[model samples]
Target: MTLSAQLGIIVGYLVLALLIGLSAYRLTDRTAADFYLASRTLGTVVLLSTTFATLLSAFTFFAGPNIAYHEGPEWILVMGLMDGIIFAILWYVIGYKQWLLGQQYDYVTLGEMLGDRFGSGLLRGLIAAVSLLWLFPYVMLQQVGAGTALETLTDGAIPYWAGAGLITAFMILYVVLAGMRGIAWTDTLQGAFMLVVTWVAMLWLLTAIGGPTSATAALETEAAAHVALGSDHYTPQWMLSRALVIGFGVAMFPQVNQRFFAAGSRTVLKRSFALWPILCVLLFVPSFMIGAWAHGLDVTVPADGNVLPIVLTEFTPGWFAALVIAGAMAAMMSSSDSMLLSGSSYFTRDLYRPLAEFSSRDVSERREDLLARVGVVVFATAAFLVSLVNPATLFELGDAAFSGFAQLALPVLAALYWRRTTRAGIGAGILLSQTFYLLSHFTTVVPGTYAGWTAGVVGMALGLGATVGVSLVTTPAAAERRALYFDGNETGAE
Candidate 1:
């Protein structure tokens, strides 16, 4: 009966998602711009919700709580409070400028803008490559979360592989069918569902576990460390580093950056960002508290740190538990679909379009759309295979993904604001930073002694240094090009 209830809830949720996709498909036009970017028609609400939903991924749903369960509530401080402010600032700083440029130039991808700015196919390819490297792992994290959630919810009745496949299949169908329009619409719905279910589940759990006061009291008595913040793991430097990396890195994610192109206007973008911090507080506080509460509960946390399902099954009724599981699944699928779409867009717009003999203007829009859909399938399948391996904890995988993308922050900023930024300099910065980060991952060069400082931070600093130093020695971009981006009142230079 329990298994049937759980299956029914999941199937029902997926059907709703499919219907939303079909609706989006019905409205979608055949143009590449319309297919890839929703014709830049997203309003304030859908823009905010889709970006919020895409940003808060399986990592937040599963790994965040898992970290809090073991490490204490400091995870909330690292991501919930600090990350909220950090990303909000970035949204204002990077997003507005990107939207302005995208509006004037009709750019659908970040790589396209950067490549045109620098006139370097190498730079374009580099950005796309780095994005894919980080994006692949992040997408795999969603699959892992989905598989683990279902496996735990059904008590092994549904295997991990089956769970992962189910999400992959649904995501592929919806994304390929409707593209960005479908993704945004579905994301808005999923985002709202996630917020409501998570809050309700948290309130219900708190009440059942003798309220917040009782939970904290139990934690203090049984595991005082879980309530406090003196662990060797979280240092001031470490926390600050995490805040910076995630703040800058998340802003540059291909999927998130593409949303800049999807916004109807600057007003819509601003309105969405204004509401982001509040949403963060609502969603993350409860999630981390749930994990902290689980530390004090009688339940045994799983080895994989998938405590959400265990808590839901043990504390909540089967029906409520199933719905909450669906919410979690919603978070995973929303993020996965966005990432898959962005990855395909990067390949199609940045990589293939440049190298292909056929002019994009000359080619049929249907052919281009078909190619993008194929890329989506290929990328999703690869990510699914990686999820089967289950390489690391969700937190660790998320950290790696953030680190790789964060390295691009310096280069991206330079391209936007620093007219003196040369192609060689930007290329040097990206290559050096990524190389350093990769080496640090494999080697003991960057000791784990510091709390928030990782190889990624070190690499970012090096990349920034390299960019500045190289730009000094190299020729600056043309005055016309500089004027195009930086000159007041002008949209862009033709």
Candidate 2:
């Protein structure tokens, strides 16, 4: 397709998104709950669609398929299919508990619930800090993806910086003007478009590459001896370890946590989680297949990561290819909006609120919502600047940033089920785990960091141990505070 036609497609998509954002403005409530949580009024269909679409981002559309092309079908087994199942299970097992508590406590951010549970502002502050820190890099990822997509669509006439800037501007405008209401509705439309594009691309790729049997045979026949599973590489240990690192670390990310908390009810959350696996299968199965098919077509893999886009252009028609490119933009922007909103919430509620000593009870909720909107602009600006430099550092920062947050997941989970978990203990655990995880992440000599997943594991272990030990040594939180943390409802007689 010519550059003019591609620009037309891109403009049309943006206009459609703008209309949705404008329409949702009336649906938005003036209060903090309305802006941030949608007044807990999200129905099953809206919640499910938004969550699924939000989760499917630039990484899923691009890198996921690229992994399959380079690594063969085993990559699907190792990362693609299993990753979806893990998310589904997480929703049921871990997410349900969070939903149950969020409703009872009327929590907006995960940090808010943590602060209340642990009876410590500092702990909540730390969670907020970690969330904001990690989320910057995530926003950077979307910025990079948007730049890449536009460059491809415009045939490099629009540079990466210009494209990223445009995306960042759109995100800040929509999020600030409409808040979560704007983001949720935009995600609904963007996600549906991506879904259509994915299936169309997949079907065409399969036909162009021959049937399933041919694709499978070609991959197996061309497999490198060194790269094959059970060789020096891709062994049982290597395979399982890689899967666990990508699965667990990505799952523990706070952006996903925001989605879980956004869910209005336990039933809606459960149904969404259960249905996510099917989407994962449908979206990725074809991408992985296309990756393998590339081997037979003798197409030089672009940048190791560019394989998916390369194959799309090579095999699909121009108009269809342009649509898929626009879909990539949709996927990237959906995740960006979610991450920016989450980061802003953490900054406003967890960081600035405590440090400024504002009483949540006394403040006008409208003012609080305004602060969150301002924070979104601040975060997006910083992310755009960071995109100007080395983009890969963004993902590395993700690893370094969230080690602390991941450690607290254990204490947060513990506080729900274990009544005896004292504030002092949980607080100590959070400190110890974060300190150790950061130190370990920097030190290659440390065996744990090489393993990648060990940062969270080791951090959680140290944090938990120290927390429990400290609580036993010191006095517990007041009986009333303890009741609220453990059971969600206080029974005064107890």
- Candidate 1: what lDDT? 0.84
Task: Identify the runs in model 2 with alpha carbons over 4 angstroms from their true place.
Answer: 80-82, 224-252, 358-366, 391-405, 442-457, 464-474, 485-494
Q: For candidate 2, lDDT tens digit of each residue in 1-494?
A: 78778777776787678679789988887876777777776667777667766666666666656655655556666555346765566566567777777778888787788788766787788878866766677678778777776776565798889888988887787777776777788877877777777777878877887866776666667775412555443456555554444454454566667666677666777667667767777767766666656776667765624566677778887777777877777777777777777777778888877876755445456667778888889889988998878447323443444444556666665665666677777777767776677667667645563343455566666777887788778777653266664444755323
**Each prediction's whole-model lDDT (CA):** 0.84, 0.69
297-368 in candidate 1: lDDT tens per residue? 898986785988889899989988889888888888888888888988898777777767335455555676
Rate residue 356 of model 2 by lDDT.
68
Clash list (residue pairs), candidate 2: 69-291, 425-467, 429-463
Please give each candidate's TM-score. Answer: 0.95, 0.88
Give the TM-score comparing model 2 with the true structure, all chains together: 0.88
Name the lDDT value of residue 335 in candidate 1: 87
Error of 1 at 372 (Å): 1.0
Q: What residue runs in model 1 are displaced by over 4 Å at the alpha carbon?
A: 358-364, 443-452, 477-480, 488-494
